[model samples]
Target: NKQGRRQSTISLSTGSGEPISLSMPASGERRLAFMDLLLKHHINGGELSEEDIREEVDTFMFEGHDTTAMAMSWIIYLLGHNMEVQDRLALEVDSLFDDLHSEMRNESNSSSTTEITLDAIKQLKYLDCVVKEGLRLCPSVPLIGRSATEDMTISGHVVPAGTVIYCFIYQLHRDPEIFPDPEVFNPDRFLPENSGGRHPFAFVPFSAGPRNCIGQKFALAELKIVLARLIRHYRFVSLDQP
Candidate 1:
């Protein structure tokens, strides 16, 4: 996927005739960037065509920019109205960071530094639960659609091939059978002790399957990092009347 234009070049022209090039990144310099990965997939003949790469890039931009921001907004709103949950999550984040700093101090003998790496974020267990419950309560994408690839019988109803199936994520997440007191913003519902045997499909905010969102992990990591930093620095308060 060298930007050197070795194998192929693709571009789109605007009404003004200005070409927008899908310039490839330099070779052997994969920096874990999304565009670089998309270009690599395209240049390496890895099942992604030029058009597919274009669509993927567009989708990635939208999801990364908009939906993830929406998720954070909803999580902050939930935390605002529920200060108890916010305080508890903040405590978890603080404890983890303190321990991380202590480890750094011991390693450095005299100096201590903090970095919010994946390992550090993983220890913020309560923060993880808070994000999950926020998503369950207010999914950024409230619904997802899929088409049946083959004929299937679902609870006596016949679903033929190519039949479009739509999943209402909001309703599914609020199923009283799956989530007791569904309207409540209880992050503990996602705690391992309380979530021992929940259905896999009970909470699919991003939809579950092979075709599921590719950015889910990256989005969650971003959420944790941003939320961790925000909660540590400031407390959110809802000024609106409930």
Candidate 2:
């Protein structure tokens, strides 16, 4: 019970201990419990060992929490400066929840029983458009690096093998052909009519293909839930000049 004693000691040692204790959950305890569950289920099994779990936890804790927090910050900043977009998002969320509620009633299910289904979240097209456009404008990780496995020719220039390549996602997102009038904060660019014909690599916020993020879906779902809840409760202020 070292963890319990440590928490208790920390709680008693501080001047503003009550607030600190209230503000922060016992993360150590929570993490241990999560690990116990994972071990019980043998979730990682042969794919990962104890050391692998440590490394994965380190990577995920840093990448997942920091990147998502930064993304949400950018989204808030964008929404604050774009009233029309915020209004549209709010309306979309309202309509989706109303429809979801109706569907639940028709199915004779409790609200808790009717979880946020993939189809339901997919139907939040406008909200999804806003998120896509936000990522296009201010991607969380602005740049990424890769090393060449073999000699390659890019733009007719032959590059030696094992060369480090820095891909600028910011510049890619600003390409005129890929995103017409790319500087504009227009979510309509992600509309089904406009997006259907565009090149797939035009938007690589979460990178692309096999090397892409495994938590992309989880991240997007978390974002949508937070945004939907926030919009339903509060109308965001637009701080930009007309």
Candidate 3:
């Protein structure tokens, strides 16, 4: 707890109140609150080592902001180009709850009690498809680079140990065989019937395997909430100047 407060104080002082003026969410506060709870319950007697806490906090901020911002920009661009898909998405958003008044009441009730559930999100299949397809088209990070720990052979090509390998997610996603008319912005491609037979790695906007993103659920939830609210309020139209 002291360490967290110290870090926040240092950040504030070093920036001459610029960081505080930015008024970003106090991630420092969240960490401190969690640590306080742990101490109160005797779950953790000692503080997290400074290095460990800093690394974890850095990782969280990088992944949280970068990935979601990129995904949102791509989704909005996709919607701008594909009016039909955007219209369908707007309709789905509109039909999700009974009406605006009912939805407001439900939101208030839900806020007071339980957090939004995965089940509620699952019901909005169309919105999900839009997000998934947008991710496929413009993955936030286009390529994933990894180094081989040991020598490996694939398709008669031997990769020497310590060789750096680049997996081109963007190219893989646009492969004609995997995605018919790959250039088109068609969210229906993510529909169960269409996506079922595809190789799992064929559509890895969040990547695959154990190291895959841990915040995929959080990102999806944020997208759904934002899209639902935006579509219900004002319609989007591309500016002529652009």
Candidate 4:
């Protein structure tokens, strides 16, 4: 009734007359919690129910934390095995600092504060390639669930409507034709020259098309920041090295 989209009923009933725990306190602390926001919206005649609120909150917490943790762990492990790559990344980060300080030295004629800002971090082209390669090798979500909306033929196989499909990202990433020496940890593989003329779907760590991960950009940026900081200070060594 509010907008074009149908809103869930605020009246706490699970359709089967079963009691659902969606207790909203009258007044409490500041607007910090999800439940607080839900209560506010409900009071304002917004139609999202307790289950809706809970499900949304759970998705946010679970998906955000778990996936990011997995990606970071994999990136760290990959870096450990590839000291040369880590060293190169660190050098690039240092060069950025040097460039910044040089510009400041010319501007104010004194040493400047060398801090990595979001804008500056985004400019790290080599680092960007490294992270992309890492993601291609070990996507946090190794598989994505999708269903066909219409009948289609893929690789000569007719896929009927309503057919549930699981795209194996990990296996696809290792396709020898698309990625030669697929098991190798080569950041250069993601370089512009190498990536050019390649199939777009060949390297879809964040999935592809309209249903691709909504948090891909945020997650990649977070990964870059963390990896940049870590590489700058510590030289991670492989424990398996004899």
Candidate 5:
């Protein structure tokens, strides 16, 4: 609602026979950053108490680190299970490293150590696809829920206001219509050409929209660096392998 005024809200039946309406005070003004909003403005009726702020900060730290770590571990597991994919990733990253080193060696100060800068990591296009595909197969946060502040229709289904919408991101990622052979670990699924005409929301590994994961870019970069370095140095073998 706006200014504490009751807005037309919907009640969602949570399968427990109880209809519940979830509401939060409408944002008055947009701030430059989330921290600015958190620190400056009063949201959801009034200013968030110190305890609320601390909880928010703690949630971010815990969720961000845990989700990224799990996603990276899942990616490593996928690579281990698929030797051909692992080999391909290694080959791609090796080529990228070779190019980067060659370019660095060409510098006048050839003694400068070659390091994986952000720009250098971005050059690994194949690795990016691999990461995206891995996320699609195994999303860290499998579910997300949002409430409808207003009445809306989705796919011809009328969703009343105040209705809680629970999205199963894991199922969405594996939707056969959106991703053919969705269960397969095929990095090519995310290739620019291959992914053309796909629904943007088909992949929600880190959720999406206004409340999407704030550290998604940082997490992806970290995952790429860790995976690239590890793959370049060692070949991972699955436990199932004799």
Candidate 6:
């Protein structure tokens, strides 16, 4: 190994002699793991301790796992019932398939996310809308609470400082004034032309403002890549009574 660094390998395979496909870093570049980054800060940056690393890792696992899994489940459900929507998305996903090999995946901005190229994921316009619509219909956290720092008036009502404001995302998403026929699983609502006029805070699946969820972009990237792969490989249909 270069610079007296020993390389190691761990294999999870049977000796059946089947070829394996995995994307790798460029010829001379080495990849860094998430923990490696944390360890680097722990040692060099001196900002993260061993305990801090452990807690951050735990938070990453806990926050990123179940909620993303649940979002995928709900998106799958929506795709199943909405065959036309799924078909359109499938066409979009398929158009990008030629550019992305079936086994194609490479690390993006974060290792704790799906490995598909960020550029490829960005090309998934319909899938992006689908995920947003899915989250709107089935947000992981149905409600969020925030405290008002200053007195303000909303809807012609007065509010005082230090007041706890509970926003019911479940109900907010279903408001017909904001989203026409909100109950319908419509991804078009997120299209740029249609969404341009919507208020920034109109959609708050991951909360909003400075105190928002730190992992919002990470979670969205993860969900999009995973869903892209799944939809490319399988066609889902609802089994429920029509």
Largest TM-score belongs to which candidate?
4
**What TM-score goes with each of the models?**
0.78, 0.75, 0.73, 0.81, 0.75, 0.69
Give the local distance difference test score of model 6.
Answer: 0.79
Q: Write the per-residue lDDT of candidate 4 for residues 113-232, one digit (tens) a residue.
A: 877778889889889988888888998888888889999999999999999999999999999998899999888988899899998998888889997878888888888888877877
lDDT of 3 by residue, 66-88 (tens): 77888887788778777788888
lDDT of 6 by residue, 120-214 (tens): 88988888999999999999888999989999999998999999999999888898999999999999999999999898988999889998889
Q: Which stretches of candidate 5 lie over 4 Å from their true place?
A: 1-48, 108-112, 153-158
Q: Is candidate 2 or candidate 3 better by lDDT?
A: 2
lDDT of each: 0.86, 0.75, 0.71, 0.79, 0.79, 0.79
- Tens digits of lDDT, candidate 5, 190-231: 889999988878888878899998888898999998888898
Task: For model 4, state the Cα shift of residue 113 in Å.
Answer: 3.4
In terms of lDDT, model 4 sits at 0.79
* Clashing residue pairs for model 6: none
Off by over 4 Å in 3: 1-31, 34-51, 99-118, 240-242
Give candidate 4 misplaced runs (Cα > 4 Å): 1-35, 42-46, 105-112, 155-157
Clash count (model 5, backbone only): 2
How far out, in Å, is residue 204 in model 4? 1.1
Q: In candidate 2, which residue pairs get closer than 3 Å at backbone N, Cα or C atoms, i.e. clash?
A: none
Q: Output the worst ten-in-a-row residue range by lDDT, candidate 2.
A: 5-14
